[model samples]
Target: MKNLIKINSKINENGSIDFKELNIDDFKEFDYYRIVNPITKEIFYNDNGKLKLIHNCHCYDIWGNNKSCDYCVSTNALVTNSTKKKLEQIDGNLFLARVFPIIFDDKTYVLELFQDIGDSYVKTENENLQLSQIVTQLNLLASKDSFSGLFSHGFMYNKIMEITRDNIMPVALLCMDIDNMKYINDNFGHYEGDVLIKKISDELIKLNSDNVFAARTGGDEFQVIFINYTKEMALDYSKPILDNLEKILIKDNYYASTSWAIEDRIKNQNAKELIESADSKMYKVKDIHHKN
Candidate 1:
């Protein structure tokens, strides 16, 4: 290790290496390691306690469940100690490095090192990066709506196709429009209107059931796709929002009316068609409210 460091010092003019971020070439050049502050969840240092150089990569692309992997000396050291006893004892895939605590002036620091035994460490690094990317993409697909935080028209259509493929279950679609939304935006502010949309969305979220999915279909218009819900359930769920309209207006010092259309699962109905039906109903209801 001493000889390796001595040789590296001559080649590495800058005199620093990021242990956690080491590739095969880097692993070969420098004895790499890491230091992790468990409490803070901060990977403070790499080999020789140096700040790592961040490449032009997004956080999701670079780090997965393994954070501060680039500067992991604690892992390297464990691999080192084990390899010294039996060359064959080193495992290629599974590597665990022991963490050593350095206490100085009431502060404790831990360091971990990596041991390279198998194929070129570059291959391993690339594989890890690929895995990180896949995990990120999967999470994004699962957690977020295709368009904005609201369900996209296309996404809703796809879901409807799947849910109504067979006589599998009953589904209901509730479409809504923010009444006088354009007027509010023009009079009060666009920013306030945006806030109102978010507030209404939040209120809808509070009213959601286990099987309920809410989405923003268009500007000032939203929908709730209810799977296996009865007409009574749909009406009951909507009452909260309708009842709370005055409270929301008073709290925010702005008046916003809402109109809605509801539908139940029927033969040959798709998400697009369902949305259109609800939208038409909503418009009719809106006209009635305006006239009154």
Candidate 2:
């Protein structure tokens, strides 16, 4: 406190002196003074590093945390040029008093004022990343079958409607079911039956093409709907899936049978109704397999 009192007394004693007579030592202990480069917006301050100066006039809350005010236009101008001009003072919550060009040795430096701005910029960026992750999870849950990871029945219907609306032709729907799947679960372990379901779904998805949509619609039941396809095209598409199934079974030493039917002739039926028709036909094929 005694030292501060002495400093203040010295400043008062120098009152009314010509400004040019003052030197750097005159304000050596001044607590609040800043030097900043105008073009880079970089800031410097007195030896204590407590006060930063630039040309903006706003309250602490307005500019965000540690952000200087926006109205420091004159300070910015001085740092960009090489001449001295009369300083101007303007009104605001805070404003720059003057812009001084400091020439040290051969290089030039600038001095400006700064004020605090608030802290919302970083928070908004983090919120965007979290929102993106949520959208991705919701889509996965909506499109997937909970048990088999195949397409859900609702997704299949939506796809059929979407394709048909696009001016496609010769659409066919084929519903399929595993023959005696429940019987296998009753006799063998449910784990073994689950393996069979997974195997069938894998084979079906591998048959994906521009025209086909495959899904496991229910337990032990699956379906494929083909767009822009004829009866012959449907059969040709099914052949690869059937052959793949035979290879998988022979490799695993497990026997599972599936039945599917193409409902291309039923043009009058809507998507759901068409799937039902193919489902009924699939049951007939399953019954024949059972009898044999």
Candidate 3:
């Protein structure tokens, strides 16, 4: 179908749409459409509950409610000023819903799209299924540490960037380093050292939850990001991890004295700064531990 593509959206221009506002006709391509003011839950970007744009396609009934869905991620995207996507089920059909913020008439608006995706992965052949499994395995391997099954440094950094860019507020980072791993490896053997590393990875992995992403950022070093966290909570989390590692026997007269650094996100918009801040704190603690 040919589209009535606009030469320009004229979002911020002087000669914009009538009254510098928008209507349902602005987004005519979608199955169902609405230009929303997230703060007011109305159509169009306005201070009051005034709808500037509202239109529905024939399939609107399949979506259930006439108003916006409850617990919408659109609200989150609006708050964070970022784009968010989610897969939702409605009337036995699956849809990939996207929410993004846009500027219009010098105000903020929420643009939403719901794409149908109910039958995108139905393959009948066994070979095709095996090939799909291989692709999935490859993707997982790319993001994981082969030895410990924890997230690799590269993938962890990528996730940190994603988290920082997203609307996850009150985030905290914890960087940890194992004590004297080289000594353990040199005297006891690399095998025993590997066992200790695996033990640390296992304990760290056990702390995983909906709000945390844990990764092995370096040899004898691990990092975890806690969403909606505080300094006190991060310390509370550290105690359990140290207690768990205390149960493992590294060697006679030898014990693990791990050091950690925790930092909350405040005025930092990049992952490198956040990780470095935590890392610097960890080193200070490690240096003191070594001296004593």
- Lowest summed lDDT over 10 consecutive residues: which window, candidate 3? 1-10
Kindly list the per-residue Cα lDDT of model 2 for residues 120-236, writing each as its tens digit: 222454554554345345544645577777776655755664444444478877788887777778777788889889989888887667667787877888877777787788888
Q: Which stretches of candidate 3 lie over 4 Å from their true place?
A: 1-134, 246-248
Error of model 2, residue 183, in angstroms:
1.8
Model 1, runs deviating above 4 Å:
1-148, 208-210, 250-254
Per-candidate local distance difference test: 0.53, 0.54, 0.64
* Model with the higher lDDT, candidate 1 or 2: 2
Tens-digit lDDT track of model 3 for 19-73:
2445434433333334555544455322243433433322223345574332345
TM-score attained by model 2: 0.50
- In the order shown, the candidates' Cα RMSDs to the true structure are 18.5, 27.2, 12.1
What clash count does candidate 3 reach? 1
lDDT of 1 by residue, 91-144 (tens): 223222334554333555444444444344324667656644554454335333
lDDT comparing candidate 3 with the true structure: 0.64
> Over all chains combined, what TM-score does candidate 3 have?
0.54
How many pairs of residues collide in each model?
A: 22, 17, 1
Better of 1 and 3 by lDDT: 3
Clash pairs for candidate 3: 43-52
